[model samples]
Target: MVRKPLPDYYAALEIREEADEVTIKKAYRRLVLQWHPDRNPADRETAEEKIRLLNIAYETVTNPIKRETYDLQRAASSRKSKAKPRSAPRVEVPKEFMMTPLGYPECFVRSLGRRVVVHSRSDDPESNFQSFFASTKLALWWLPEVNNMCRIRKLGSKARGDKRGAAAGRAGGLNMAFDPQKAKTAGAEGSEVRMAPANKGQKADSVNFVTKASPTCEGALRFESASQRGQYLAFFPPSHLRVVPFLEEAEDRVLDFLFVDFASMFKFITLEEVLQPIFSAEEAGVWIELAKLQDDEAVKSHFKEVMGKDVWDVEDFQAYFEGHWATFEYNAEEKKARMRPKQERLAKQLRATPKAEEVVAAVAKTDESELQRLPVGALARALTALAKASSTDGEAGEATSAQIQLLAALRAVGKGEEEKCDIPAFELLHSAEKVLDLGGDNPDDTVLVQRSAAARILANKALKSASAIEGGMVEAGFTLPDVVRFLLLPGAAGRDLLLATSCVKLFEGRSIPEQREVLRTAKSRGSTNTAAAAGTALLKSLGGGGPGDHVAAPDAHVEMVAEVAECGVRLPAATALLRRMAATANPLKLAEALLALASRVGPGQAEDMTHIAESLASKGAFGNFPIKTILETVLASSKDDTLAALVVPAVPGHVYFALLVL
Candidate 1:
């Protein structure tokens, strides 16, 4: 007879009733991709119908209740087929099975309910029967298909109310056997039966034996007494009857006995549920062992599994492991102390070397003009060499030389003296400006040159506008001296003069004192070397003072004297201005200017001015000299001057004694 066709949806999807949602969805994606009408236009109509049916089957089977119902119907149909009588057909066992050591028994049942009869084992001894019953418990316990059928039957009876009374009777039997008092109390409320604990004084109603119905059978069978079945109804429930083992002999094995008793007590339990506690205990033990082996090869294996080989090669991973171990061994204070110096050393090395591609890029982009140049690739190589240099004293000497070369290159950039190099002048200028503006330990001389060059650039750019020049100079931290020097270059002198004159005019009222103070400070700081030269040049340009003409006083003498004196030293130009003033016919004004000029003259020059002093005395200008009056008028006022004046006793004493004698 031909087998009845499976449901069209099932056949379309090629899935069993037992297929899970994930399986169904997978099958659907595959079938839809293959047999969808769009994919197979030649079979469009049939493919479309198949696709529709597939969708319906997937939807129906994916729903839990619908899937379960479908499974039951399929199972019932299978059972009905097995129950039907069939004409005997010639059966041929596969030769491989016959050649195997284990032979078929007198009767054997296949998974699909096909049976084979063997006349040879039917009349076998009772001892063989006993042996078969002894080994069938594990086999019976593992038959999921048979257990599933039993579950469905039990559920079906309960749904019809017929199994409720039977279930209640079983629960009553269990209560009477193991928990009579609690059972009586629970019975009043019709509560569920509780399984007896292993330690409880309860004897198992039946012992399950592992038996093969035939030598060729792969699984075991289970049996229960008609009266004891109620007490162990959940364990040997009708749903589980197919796989139940017979009680033939008592075995002292705990696992075997426990499995039998457990199966009888919780008949409705799934195979997975039955094995859960034991498997969970085993899993927990395995985890404990795993945790204990954290430093073992197993841990390495696990790491390999989770992170792959590359993780161990990473610097961060190495650092973390090293740090972890270091921390474990050393206290916080020790660890900090040990790490601090090493970290600082590492950072120093990092800074000294260009570690990143971007830093290398920056170095490459640097533009060193004629005044400031360095080979970019050579610098990088030097840094890399320094990075690799040993920290030992001998190696350090070589490293130091390398460092000096690097610093020299940097300084050349600062000085704007390097040949056609790529270093950025603006960066060097800004760095120099920062150093000067912030004023720290004496900055490198190259830094000063850089500041000077930057000031010159800015001043030259701003030459037309005095405000712009001052703003640029001030922004660059250029001292007034720097401005003067920057402006003194051949092309810049005229603009410099204009700028200075404009500044004097603009701040004549509000900032004259500040301007004077800045010039005064610059003078004290000996920054007026350039300024003095520039002023003398400008005076000569105006024709008031000829070169080497000490007899003539320039028209600019008052301002020039103040500025030059503020410079705190007398150049030849300044001495010429002083000599002209002292020789004037207005001897009093001349003497005053003479004394002012004398005050600023260095001691070495003042010592050589004895005749000038005697001349001032003969003119009687010394008697009323501001120097001598200060000696008697205020003791404190003479304190500094008296000491300074004594260095040239002829100048001070002749003026003072001449006043007394007169």
Candidate 2:
């Protein structure tokens, strides 16, 4: 059952339903002042009752949640009344246009046995109401374009009775249309509106343009079909709808439609609704020229104030409104000039702090190379300052500048030969590992470049010691996939050694089954680096490398063999699979086994392995193997020394062998 309706608060306040927050507050204050009990001492009881109702109304409407709940309850009551049968017989009234709750212009049309009428304006009642005929109402959707062009559609019979017009939204209705050509005749009127088939749904034919009424017709407006020249939509002497040619003399008696503003029709209005048409015109590049024709200073100043607040508050508002003088008169260069002092103040504040002073002074003087000479802890402190500032949700351009400076300092400190790991630089890497790990997958391109550079520097230093790798994983909270992504960087110095060393340290002290689970967990993360790294680590664990390679724990070699055994091979048969793979004469047999291994894995795992193999093979690192057939054929078939070919000078590579094992 529907609940009882909320009290008529808006009627009590004597304000329109679309009154804004400022207006609502103003109305409440005015009512309270006029009906205060002290001001009406002779009738204190009545005055106090009036003041009490006014306070209740004001409280309900001002609180947003209360107002929303009140509106819902009121709407429910209205719908319930609409659903009930009327006790009295129907009364025939004149056909007229009325505004729906959603602010569409609709005219009622009588048809068949049904009789309906829109509530006509009481101030200007129709003189010949008995002669009106019945038909469907047409709802007009005003489009954003030149001269207020709109689309008119026939509202379904069910929708016509709904005050909200919820059933007659923008889509799926019979529409009216007109030709594309503008009115060429020298007269006040335009073309006729034609009834368009519902199935056609073509936008071009349905557009109609409206014009402000001439002085003779006072507050009314006229709609003219775009293609039908010298005609206007009008009502005849007895209120019958028809398309008629324009005549200069007729005023209130004919040839004009009253235009009702949305504030009077819609129960609630938002700023978004008001801004949509204006922004549409702005985006279409005509708002500037249109505003020039009007000479309203109050309007221009109000708009400037609104847009200035947006420019100061929104992240990218400056880029959007830069140099648009007509709309908001915003200037990007001037805004930057205004912000220069604030940026200088921030820089001065940073320089006053002893921990950040030296780096800030160095950066201000454009001496980034001098930053490398600072102590490791000091350098890390400086980097942390800049990185934290850069990652803030501040203005986009400021963050970008901070990120650029951070990268420059990083490059200066990290610049050295790969063979000689500088003591200060390695210590800097240790100190800044947290900062590097904090860099996530930000959408900004500069952030990604900085992250890749930091990762490369860490990968270079971490390759020298397994303990550093373990520290990064266990203490710094770096996952195996994180290390894998760092190792796969384009500028990383010793990726192969780092990948193998990191994997061994990560999977150490765990069982063969636990190690397999770890590898599965890494591949399941859905990162290209994790899958490729897992495959490469697995191949290295198995005895896929040459004789000079370091031997792992005995059980590590059996993990992939177990993976293969699960794919329809018996355990005893799988134990000799790798041995037979090395001696197989038919490369197709090796290719089939690789395909079967890939088929049992997750999506994109095999593809990632193929890409890594192809990229390395293109650099001439993998000898005597056809580039196209490298992944298909076993790398074990190659010459013994070639299987351990290096990706870089210090890093022995095994990814190609891993691709074959898959």
Candidate 3:
């Protein structure tokens, strides 16, 4: 009948004895997750066993009634061994009754007394008893009651005469023991007292036994008080008792039986059973799900109803489940303390931004670590500073394209329009400037040139902000003068005129005097070459080319041609427009204008477009422009078709030959 001592429930779960239900539940969940066969593939068998033990421990010990009973048995067995040093006499006993801790009760003396000497740990705790077992014969049984202890008396006729005197003498002179149940109930606040009467009452059997404990008695040599209430049941509690017993015996023939009705037996348990929640099993699943929620309110509301206030509030339970609050708080505080200096440094930088240019330089160099060190405020301040620098440079030392783009990016962040196209003006100009500079690495890179062209619009749009911040002046980095100057550079004359023309907006608010000076400087630097080129550009620009491609130049600028032509009172805008036609207007349209003008002007009333053609011809600038185109335009508008025959004979051979060759 010897079996292993009951499993150490506390040790199985690997938690302290003081652990509360919350802690127990948490520990169980953590272990299950860690050791589930799905997660612990390498040591699945071990994990399974461990989980099994955990389930058994959690289910058995977490239940108050079961755990209480277990503790009493353990303590009782400890006292029995300690109190009785002497060996028992050899005598066989039925094994259905519980075994002593050592072996088969050491050695049982079956004759004489039927009582067992109960040795208890500490002050022997007792209780009004209950016995649930019944043998093949209704066994002679005695149970303690509220007021008096029970004693066994012989039932056979020969021993009946020895009843009262011998029984009183053999009572062992023991004091009535304290009821462990009452002591427990008195100490346990709000605990419901559970008292169920014993299954069979022996007062009805008064006719059965009347003798004192004697040497010939079959049970034991002495009778002792029942130490615990529930432990009185020889096999199982009255509620759990079943008449059916699964009978078995070993080679030694110790009578053995199992009370199959007890659901709390360790052998009846499975992993699923222990893993199951004791109370609110459904609520347990909800608790786990709530932990996954990000919204505090939802989680809080759920916890409010699911776990009543008597147990925990939302925050406490959340903290408990999340792990120790003290540790988390300490970590958070340490993190804050560690970051304080850096945060202060950044705050100071944002407040003043004295060295913002350093951050700009770092960004330009693509120093990622340094950039990362720049907080959002610091980054913004530095970017603004760099933007100021770019605008401050204007035409002086233009910021590189990279710096400008970075500034634009910062501005986008500031505007909360990173996903949109709220570009900064200075950035666009700088971008174009960088593209132009890229000519060194990429000789004649056209796509970059086009990109540079497109960037010009963003640069222009970026200007209002830049200009307002920089005192509302033109801080355009790439100037029309620069484009003009670029053309004036040696071997650059007439080159990239489309490129030069692209920068027209750079002259937006220039004074007439500035315009005059620009043209004057061009003439000085390029002689007649620059003036003629300027004149040609001016002519082409005056409503002759694609007007959409050109930004409007200053009104003062359109007058430069009239000033250069010295046309007093000058041609009307229409005439001037036609004159620009020589550079880009349709040949027929120019001829039509020529014929119209010839008919209206008598050579100098306002120096109209009367001689623009012959003037540009003197400079030999009609490499792409044909003089005959004008002639043909004039002749075609004439109603007199015979005038061409008269004019043909008067034209020079080379001029005539040039017309035919064209």
Predicted model with the maximum TM-score: 2
Q: Which runs in model 1 stand beyond 4 Å of their true positions?
A: 1-418, 421-430, 435-522, 527-532, 538-559, 562-572, 578-589, 596-662
lDDT by residue (1-662, candidate 3, tens digit) is 23334466777778877788778776766765566544664564476567656655665565553455455444433332112111234233232232222112211111113222222111111211111111110112333342223432221212233343222323222111223444334431211112111222422211111111212222222222234322111121111111111122212121211111122223222212222222124432222332223233433343344222233334433333222211111122222111123233443333233333444333454534434444334443444454344333443233344344443443333333222222333443343344333223432334333334323333333333344344332344544455444433333333333333443445454444444555565555443444443444454445435644333433343345444443221235435554444554333333434454544444342343434444333333223445665455334334333222213233345555665665
Candidate order by TM-score, highest to lowest? 2, 1, 3
At residue 65, give the lDDT of candidate 3: 39
User: What's the lDDT of the predicted structure labeled candidate 1?
Assistant: 0.33
- The CA lDDT at 559 in model 1 is 52
Per-candidate clashes come to 26, 6, 6
In terms of lDDT, which candidate is stronger, 2 or 3?
2
Error of 2 at 142 (Å): 67
lDDT values of the candidates? 0.33, 0.41, 0.35
Q: How many backbone clashes does candidate 3 have?
A: 6
Q: Please, what are the lDDT tens digits per residue for candidate 1 over residues 1-662?
A: 12233364566678765565456656766766676454664554476456556655654454333344344434433332112111122122221111111111111211111111111122222224323222221111111222211110110012222334213322111111223233234432211222221111223332211111221122212222222331221121111112122222212100011111212212211212222233244422222221222334533443444223222322222222222221111222222111222222222223332323323233333333411333332333334434333345444443344344444454443343223322222222222233232112433354334434433333333333223434543443444444434334323543434445433332223233334443444344344543443444433432243544334443334455546554554444554555544443344454444445555665554433443444444555434546654343223224334223223233466555655765
Give lDDT tens digits, candidate 2, residues 314-383.
Answer: 2232322321111333333434211112223223323222233334444554444544443233434455
